[model samples]
Structures are given as structure tokens and as C-alpha cells.
Target: MTVPLFPLNSIVLPGGRIPLQLFEPRYLDMLTRCMKDGIGFVVVLLRDGAETGAVARFHPVGTYVRITDFQQLGNGLLGITVEGESKVAITRSWRQPDGLNMGEVEVLSEEAYAPVPETYAELTSVLVALCRHPVIQDLDMTVDYADARQVGWRLTELLPLDKQEKQRLVELRDPVERLSRLQELLEALESG
Candidate 1:
């Protein structure tokens, strides 16, 4: 299916929530159509260039997201909260006349439910503590501490990992492998 692509330097994995402001004309139009049609859009990680003006290069794998809440901020910008639904692969992309990026995409398969392994169980505990922070509580994320997929994704999003590292994790289809990678990264973080 074809969907609008909102490229950013950051990556949001499935089950993650992100707030964005719509001010660009093309983006504003895209938001209107998506909300009216009750469809979602793809948030791809920008590989090069900027988010506005010229067309930017973005990673093929992206998270399909739907607008969950919206408000007109006091500054007059339209603030919208979007929740990630699933991962999508962009097969082809092009810019419209108004500079909005559109893409032909296929939704990636969801990870099967896998319980967190004993070795990485500590990661889940860390995630639980991170979620208790007021800033994270505001996102209202539904995380299952026992599920490997949930534990991997929530930690990958909440951790101070670089954008490329997060994108790599988001593209991974295996929950266990993702968790293993996170554990290794966390270990290295502690050592450094």
C-alpha cells in the first residue's frame, strides 16, 4: 500500500509513541488526509539531508504509525501524538508536487511473543524503572515486562543509544536477537 512518509533523524519502533508538530504545508496536508481517511503514515529515519525543502534520503524500514491524540498548542503549532503500529518496508518512494514524500510500502511481519530470557531479565527491570519517570509515564506506553519483544523495544527506545543503533534494532525481526544486542550494548555502556 502507498502511504505518506515522514522522515526524521530519530526512529520509533513498534509500540512506541512520539509527539510531532505539523507546520510545513505539505506535512499539514498529509496529516489532514491521513486523519480523514482513518489511515496511518510511515515514519522513516532520515539517512541524509533535512526534513524540509529538498527530498531527503531515508532508511527503507520504518514504523507505521497512527495519530492517537492531537491539540493546538498555545504557540499555534498543531501538536499530534502518534503511536507506532507496525514496521513497514518502503519499496519505492517519490515526492509529490507539494514536496510531500509518498511511498509504496509493505508491512513487515510482527514478532512472535517470546518471553524474556533469564540472562536479559535484568533489562526488563531497568525498563520498569525507566517507565516510572514522570516523562515516560506521560506517554502511556503498554509494556509487557515478560515479553521479549516488548522488553527489547521499550529499552531500545528509552536508552541513550544513537539513532543508527536504534534504527538497527528497529529493523531487527527477531526479538531475542534484539534483546541480546541491547544487553551487549548496555554492558559496553557500563564498561565505558
Candidate 2:
């Protein structure tokens, strides 16, 4: 399942809302095409040497996202809402004529009901509290616990962490390991 690519330093979890400003010509073209085709694109993390047009350095794990809403901001900037649909891996990437990057992506799917560790339930409660904290309360959000197995991904994105840490979360395949790592992150944030 090849799809277009939109590289950012942020993690977008399934059922999450990511607002983006599209001003770059290539991305504008990508957005237009997505609207025309009724399809979405993969949101990947930009790795080292990205500015040099290095296609080989992007993170493999990404989220397949759909454009749920769009509004034209002044100065030709587009305010777009991206709703994550699924995970994907980058097979390849190429530069499009309009300057936006496109990629050959393979969508990844998890089992319908992967067992989540008991500890995750506790961690999730903490995360819910953190989301409601006064500092982050104005972020315009909601709590989605539809997939317990994906709670780690959602936390990784919600936390104000560095891109490297989020990338590590995306690469982790084991649910238990991912949950443990997320717990550690939350603990660290709480202590700080």
C-alpha cells in the first residue's frame, strides 16, 4: 500500500488529532492529491541528514493518517486536521516535482485484542490525569481508550518529550516492553 509521506518530528497515535500548517508547495500538492483521491498519507519522523535530501534516513514506523478537516488560513497557509488511521512502514521515498516527498508505504495492523499488561491500566489512569492537568487542559482534546494495546503510542505522543524518545516508542513492537517504557517516561516526567 504505497502512500504519500509527511515527515514531522511528532508522533501521531491512532485516533489522535494532529493539526498541521501546509505552506510548502510540495505538501500543498500532496494535500490536494489526497483530497482528490480520497486517501491519506504516512506521517514519518525525519531522521539525520534529512535536509540533504537523504531518503534512507527516515524512521520506518509511521502512522497512516487521513485529512479529516481543513481550513484556509491567511497567507496561503492551510490549517489541516489529520486523524490517524493505522501504522505503516516506509518501503521507499522519492521527491515529487512539486517538492513534496512521496513514499511507498506498507500499512501495519495489530491483533484486534492484544492483551495489555495489568500495569498499563494503572499507568493509563495517571495519563488520564496528566491530560487533564491545568497546564495541558487547553490543548483541545479528548480521552480515547479504545485500544488498550495502543495506549503507549498515545502517551508517547501526548507527553512533551523529544523526537528521539518518541521514535524509540514507535520502534518498540512488544506490548509489554512498550508499556514498561511508557511507564518509565511517565515516572520521569512526574519526578521532574
Candidate 3:
């Protein structure tokens, strides 16, 4: 299914909720369309250029997301939250006259569930701490924390990593391996 593309300098893994503020005319229209049709959009990290100007280049892999909740902020910007649904790879993209990007993408499968090592079970406390950030805290409340793969993805979203690193973590097929890598990164951060 072709959906509108919203490129940003961020990565959102499946089940992650990313909040966005919409004010631009093109995106407002996109939002109107999404809310009307029950369609979502592909959010890809920017590889080059800006979100509002120029022919911005973006990573082909992205998260397919649907708007879940929204409210009007005091600033008058439409504050909306989108929850990641699945991964998608852009086959090609083009821009409309107003500079909004629309892409032909193929939806990818959910990351396969691999049994996480028991040692990483203690990481749940760390995740709870990470979720204290208001922006992310709500997104995970509904998840089954005992599910190790969900734990891995939650950590992936909370990590202080670059967009590319987060993208790599999201693309990892094995949740067990992803957890292992996340543990290593956490250790490095603590030691430093």
C-alpha cells in the first residue's frame, strides 16, 4: 500500500510511539487523509537534507506507523502520536508539487522472536527508568514486559544511539542477538 512518507532524523522500532507536531500545510493534509482513511505513513530517517526543504534523501528502511492519539497544544500545533506497526522498505519515492514525499514501499515482516538470555531479564529495571521520559513512558505501558523480544525493542528505543545505530538494531532479525548487543552497549555506557 502506498502511504505518505514523513522523514525525520530519528528511528522508531516496532511498538515504539513517536510524538510529532504538525503545522505545515502539506503534513496537515497528510494527517487529514490518514485520519479519514485509517491509513498510516512511513517514517524514514533522513540521510541528507532537511525535513521541510530540498530533496531530502532518506534510508530505505522505515517504520510503518499510524496515528493513535492527538491533542492541540497551547502553541496551536497539532500534537499527534504515532505508534510503529511494522517495518517497510521503500521501493521508490517521489515528491508532490508541495514537497510532500510519497513512497512505494513493501511492508516487511515483524522481527522474529528469539529467546532472550535469562541474564538480560534484570534489564527491565533499566527500561523502567528509561521510560520515565514523558515522551516514551506511555508507549510501553501496554506491552507485555515478560516478553524478551519486547524488552529488546524497548531498550532499542531508549538507547542513546544515533539514528543509524538504532536503524541497525531495528533491522536485526534475531531479538536474542539484539538483546546481547544492547547489553554490551549499556555496559560500555556505564563504564565510560
Best by TM-score: 1
- Encode model 2's per-residue lDDT on 1-192: one tens digit a residue: 778878786768676767888876677778888899999998888775453234435688898999988999786778898888888888878876655677888877663555566767876776677777664464455655545555676677777877898888877766568788888887788899
How high a TM-score does candidate 1 get?
A: 0.96
State each model's CA lDDT, in order: 0.91, 0.75, 0.83
**How do the candidates rank by lDDT, highest first?**
1, 3, 2
Model 1 Cα lDDT, one tens digit per residue, 55-150: 799999999999999999899999998999999999999999999999999998888999999999889888999999998898888988999998
Model 2 stretches with alpha carbons more than 4 Å out: 49-57, 74-76, 133-146
- Show where candidate 3 strays beyond 4 Å: none
- What's model 3's overall lDDT? 0.83
- RMSD in Å for candidate 2, one decimal? 3.2
Q: Model 2, residue 63: what's the lDDT?
A: 89
TM per candidate comes to 0.96, 0.82, 0.91
lDDT comparing candidate 2 with the true structure: 0.75
Clashing pairs in 1: none
* Candidates 2 and 3 compared by TM-score, better number: 3
